[model samples]
Target: MVENLTEEILEMLGNESRRRILNLLSKKPCYVSEISYSLKMAPKVVLDHLDKLEKLGIVSSYEEGRRRYYSINRNLRVEISITPHRFIASTVSETPELEIDEFIKNMENLLKTPAGSLREIYKALQEFEEVERQFSEILGAVSLKFNEMFERFLTEIEKEVEDELERLVLLGITKGADTPFKISEEYGISYMGVIKALKSLENRNIVEKLENEDVWRIKC
Candidate 1:
């Protein structure tokens, strides 16, 4: 997987346009027109570079009708300087086939709640770190008392963090920008759930939401 990623990275960097395309996309997601305008290049030229980057998995694009938006592959770390280097990313094979009994046991563990040892449970949950990473920061962005008060609510914050996790995943907003009110309406999550999630995240020092407004920010 590392070898494949290295090959892809090298292939991606071989073209100047592709490198520029990554530079434009890294700031935020953008459509072809946006990239072309930003780089002062033609749309067709941007599209060509986008295709090459996407093919190498250095970038991923989503299309909405006649328009396509491109972003750097969140999973593929790209570092640009006088020379560019993209981290070799591992490929995930088909979800490792697990026996029915094993799958059921895994589900049972996930369902077990606060009863199990948190350290072990969290270790198993490491796979989800990237997705949940922002919540920690959100809790930190709030108030001090709110942060301390909330952490004590659960036996182990990790075991009960799921509802908040699902909410954030569904909210579809980048971290530290969107407010709780906006997220609740967009994700169909309750006002209470947002509060509770923020509280839980605060307890863990994962994020902080300002007292005056629901704007959330992740802790550094």
Candidate 2:
């Protein structure tokens, strides 16, 4: 069962667009237009990616009046393992003991409370501010972990590719040089060299050009 699920998860994650969609949905629930705008993808393309994610059970959606909102399935936690013979993928509950339903109910009750005395309103505001602060701290921790993982992944790639030019191009892209021309100009490398490195990176799926655009971006 774990092997089968791993294969399915790998197949679903093979597409860059789907992975991007999942990343966006993980942060917040969003409508198709919002996702399209954020990812610089066409609405139709965004919808297609969302469809695939929903089918894979990684994302779920609901219709709100005329718009549909999509969100990640936060309950599902994916784990990957690699060995000499095979790779394994598995899923587990992210927070099996956390009563998210009860927390939501409490939050809803707080939101529905009517404004009362000035002191009462001030206390409520203080509590909400504290909650916001806690959320910020949690988000900061997640961001830090993500950065560490990205750096480690880059280090592994650096080991596989020994060419200095390719490494420069990758570093440039990581630092926000989206186009080969920009990378060349910023790094003082020849235009042809930047282009050559970019092609190699694309072939290795390290970076990709956005559809209908001249810009290339690192596929993180």
Q: Candidate 1 — worst ten consecutive residues by lDDT sum?
A: 79-88
Question: Quick one: RMSD of model 2?
Answer: 17.1
Candidate 1: tens digits of C-alpha lDDT, residues 1-220? 1456655676677878777777777789899888888889999988888777777666787888887778876464333212111122344433555696697577656545345598767865663464345644563444444544545434333464566553462232332226767767766777787777777777777676667876776655
Q: Which stretches of candidate 2 lie over 4 Å from their true place?
A: 1-114, 203-206, 210-212, 218-220
Each prediction's number of clashing residue pairs: 19, 0
What is the C-alpha lDDT profile of model 2 across 1-220, one tens digit per residue? 2666667777888989888888888788999999999999999999888887888777888889998899987466566544322234676655554587788668857655446988777877787788868876885576567667768867876896788999888877766778878899989999999989889988988889999987888776
How far out, in Å, is residue 155 in model 1? Answer: 59
Each model's lDDT comes to 0.61, 0.79
Best by lDDT: 2
Which run of 10 residues does model 2 get worst, by summed lDDT?
Answer: 79-88
lDDT accuracy of residue 99 in candidate 2: 89
